[model samples]
Target: MKPTRCPWRGWLMLCLVWASGSASAALPIEHWTQPNGARVYLVRSDSLPMLDVQIDVDGGSRRDPPAQAGLAAATALLLTQGVQASPAGPALDENAVVEAWADLGAQFGASAGSDRLSIQLRTLTQPDVLDAAVALASRQLAAPAWADPVWARERARLTAAWREAQTRPDTWAGRRFADAVYRSHPYGQEARPETWAAIDTAALRDFYRRHARPCDARITLVGALDRASATRVVDRLLAGWANHGCTALPAVPEVAPLTRPERVQLPFAAAQAQVLVGQPGIARDDPDFLAILVGNHILGGGGFTSRLMQELREKRGLTYGVFSQFSPGRHAGAFSVSVQTRPDQADQAVELIHSELRRFVEQGPTEQELAEAQAALVNGFALRLDSNRKLLDNVAALAWHGLPLDYLDRWTAQVGAIDRDRIVRAWQRVLHPDRLVTVVVGATP
Candidate 1:
């Protein structure tokens, strides 16, 4: 008897796999430009009665004007403090509004990063609450009061915080590492005591004017709402924003690799030393991004399975924990590994870290290691779309990175296709232990 070929069986298996994968795929992305010049990303889902909206403006710390180191950050913070014609009355009183939102089971906050300032809101998909939240956030973004007294108080608070950070070894090490790596670039400048003191209301307003133009912003909307209704809400909130044309961004300085290890010491009576090492890394849009990400996971990014953890913690017991990560921005960001250990073990820990980095560069992770990393990355991807808030974060990242609408759909396939050889090449190209700018505070060799 000869075995029979089952064509229908293969077809049925294919359909079943497709259906299972489709159920977890990201919602279709609809991109449109608002009349005011702000870009919007809308993803409609009826799975949950919640909505998440994020408005991103290209007005982060990098946009600060010369000699106004903290101006951009301060401007972003003040946007939520007070708006024109609001009950909070300039220097916007957030306590009352925050409490009110909490009562309504909603949340709102703002954050500023190296490349953008974002205002985010999450609320139940109820009409009245959503309408109010949208209106209030728009008003706050459009007409923030840069009052002198408010600016003065915030400056004092931020300055004190910076001063306090300077006294800590970990903070000092990170700051010095940034300074050494970026040199004269905007990334190098720290929010120092003098810089904070010089931040006045006029400076904040001027910085906002230069960077917070509608044309330079992008809005992302995700949640359980139809396109028509979401458009209406967005129009009501942001339609009034006027585009003042694009602002000229300063050219990013070319970063050079560090020549030797530099150390900064904080004279604190502590038993442990804080260390940060590595240098300027690839940009966000690099073609080898996925490969680098996977490689880093094997090197230091993955918790217990990574080379850094295995060598530093498991083998030598030099540090309780150690990890490395790549931070992507508009320009190239840092690749850093941070660790804390006893003062006497600092040099040994640093040596082990460098050794592992060099070994990974010379000979990458094994087939088993690469397969494990890929599996982890692929299997965990579904969690990214588990909620409206998480979905909105993914969309916001896509908008920020200028990725295509189909990025989410292709993500898993891309990760699956990455091979061990590609990861090895990416590791060698990006991770240079010898050229790293090392910062170790509170321990001496």
Candidate 2:
């Protein structure tokens, strides 16, 4: 289903003219649970004749066994390669599966992220086409073949890609940074050649069976379907999926916070030094997520207007560009600042980052800064929902994270209401300037 090797023959791209207004004003979401226990979220967009669907399962890399770090990713990849035969249909190999979708003028794919494994489909809303595409997707979701030959080929390709990535200095720095920040947490686990080699067909199948269940599905549908049609589509797509009395999974430990400053220095023969700094940050469900988001935009996430870019790039000429980010997830993800500069200036760059972060944490953003950030974010919010595909992704996120149904409707207003004092309070509570981790690779002696 990954349209990579075998392309769709009759794929038609849909175009629409989205009206200019508050994004929340236009999106009205409907939610319900199927009898099989899958949670469904739908947004009816009648302006287009296409349908976009996304299914999110809790089988992301975070669920992988420590010994087989990339198991979830590999499993997601193989789902599209082939499917086993069942009473509903005959078996289909990778090429045959691709041809089936191509003939239907639809696209389907599966990929794993840090928190979830997502299966997505895009197809025309014609009755005949929609039914066929949903049936094919159901085959992929319910009956992945997990063929040994395909795993062997994928592993080799991934291993070679891994080897090539290792030759880059940024990769070395990133690995060290993750290990230092996450320590014993599963969030830090990166698949190695040996780990990829260790994963066989059996482990992939086991992971899928355990995690990819109807009970755990958060399905989102967006496009030209009303509630009735959307409900029927959901039922048909999940017809082959059966609940097996789902039980709770053993909980993975949360990402631990750093107790003290940690520094990693690795010398590599490269032109520029890669410097990374920071520690564990907020989780997705944190009440202060909006405040922290605004705080980060002022710190480094607002691009040219961000403090980090203004200081490190524009004023001091330390690097061509620099950035800070908060990668919040089910658990605490990293809050990192990254930069590349001359080997000789690595230390200076790190110190500037430390000072800027410390000052911002101690004294929150100015009122003027907060106003500008709010205006920029609020005005541009509508672009986030300009297409059905984009809306599907947002709806899927809301379902997966248990965010309020009105979250999108209130996004801009809530962001605008965040004051300077709240931003300061959030920064002080969330970030520890003294306990940051620093990783500098390819630095001069």
Q: Which candidate is the best by lDDT?
A: 2
Clashing pairs in 1: 81-92, 82-92
Deviating ranges (above 4 Å) for candidate 1: 1-24, 86-105, 259-268
TM-score, each model?
A: 0.88, 0.95
Residues 1-445, model 2: lDDT tens digits: 5545222223344233342221233668999998878999998877667788998988899987788999989998998999899976999999999888877878899999988998999888877778888888888888889999999999999999999999999999999999999987888999988999899999998888888888889989988899889888888777766666788877878887788999999899999999999999989999999999988888999999999999999999999999999999999999999999999999999999999999999999999999999998898887887667777878898899999999999999899999988888888999999999999999964
Task: Put down candidate 1 lDDT per residue, 55-164, tens digits, no spaces.
Answer: 88887777665577877778777766655565434434556555545445566677778888888877666676677667666666667666677777888898888878
TM-score, structure 2 vs. true: 0.95
lDDT of each: 0.75, 0.88
Residue-level lDDT for 334 in candidate 2: 98
RMSD of 2: 3.1
Best by TM-score: 2
lDDT of 1: 0.75
